[model samples]
Target: MKVEGGCHCGLVRFEAEVADGPVEVLACGCSICAMTGFQHVIVPQSAFRIVEGRRETTTYRFGSGSARHIFCTQCGVKSFLTPRGRPDAMSLNLRCLDEGHGLDVTNVAVDQV
Candidate 1:
């Protein structure tokens, strides 16, 4: 399925392709993930494309500095990130989508902390 999403202020928009079946998401217990309520829908980089406001996004990294946490500079909404577990993939924030788009989400709890 093709999904569309963006940051809160509409400063960052993107499109991604997910599997046609159920979309499995990850709910991490790490500090950032917990604080931001990030539900990760991991998809390959090739499956995600930035449609607008690429320069309006800010990239943040911490600790291991492997994952590239990208957020909107205007609204501070983290729409997606480069995940450490899947270096070549992007972890899209399920909440950032249009009302979550009614995806069949299965949240897998991860003790990343």
Candidate 2:
């Protein structure tokens, strides 16, 4: 299934090709994810693309500085980013996906790291 999403202010937009069935997502309890309420849908880098606003985004890194927390410069919404644990993948914020994408999301495991 193909999912399209964007930041709150519509500054940054993206598209991702995900599996066409029930999907598992992670609810991370790390400081940044917890404070921002970010639910993670991890996808391979080849399955994701920035459809627009690539230049309108900014990145922030902390801790080991491996994960790149990308946000819309205008709205400060981290719709997607590169995860430290999976450099070959991108973590899309499940909450940011546009409605009617037909994603049966389940198995929401919470992790504190």
Candidate 3:
């Protein structure tokens, strides 16, 4: 299904068409991921698009300087980012998606770093 989402201020909007299923998602064992607690089906660069809010978005890189933490400058809501552990993949913050279809995230397991 096509999922549309953005930050709290709508300053970092995006649209992505993803498959409907329990995809292979990982709860990272990294310092940032451990604190933020993100989860989702990882997608390659080809799967995501910044439909709007490019100017309102800002990036923060740390650690190995591989991950690009993209978020809205207005609300500071991190809707998505490129994964450092898997440079080729983008990590979608499931908490940010507007899943009006009643998405279920209960069974998604989360392990600490």
Candidate 4:
């Protein structure tokens, strides 16, 4: 399914293609993810595209520094990231997606910490 999303301040926008069926929502117990309330909806990087506000995006990394966490500099919203384990994948934040995407959200625990 095709989906659209962006930052709170409208400084960023993106489009992505998710699985055809139910979207898998992974909830991580990591400190940063938990504190920020980030819900992971993983999709391959080839299926994701940034449509606007590219310049307003910033990258953050820590620990292994494998994943590149991309956030909106203006609104401080972490909309997506290049996942550590799957460098070829982009993990989108379900909370940032526009409504009516027909995603059947499921909570799956991840030991990211």
| lDDT (C-alpha, whole model) for all candidates | 0.89, 0.91, 0.73, 0.89
- Measured on C-alpha atoms, candidate 2 has an lDDT of 0.91
What tens-digit string does per-residue lDDT give for candidate 1 at 60-80?
A: 999899888998999999999
Off by over 4 Å in 1: none
After superposition, the stretches of candidate 3 with alpha carbons farther than 4 Å from their true spots are: 101-113
The alpha-carbon lDDT assigned to residue 27 of candidate 4 equals 92
Best by lDDT: 2
Question: For candidate 4, lDDT tens digit of each residue in 1-113?
Answer: 89999999888999999888776798978778999989999998999999999999999999899989898998899998888888989999999998887888878889862
Pick the winner on lDDT between candidates 3 and 4. 4
**Backbone clashes in each candidate structure, one number apiece?**
0, 0, 0, 0
- Clash list (residue pairs), candidate 1: none
**How much is the lDDT of residue 103 in candidate 4?**
89
- Candidate 2: deviation at residue 107, Å? 3.8
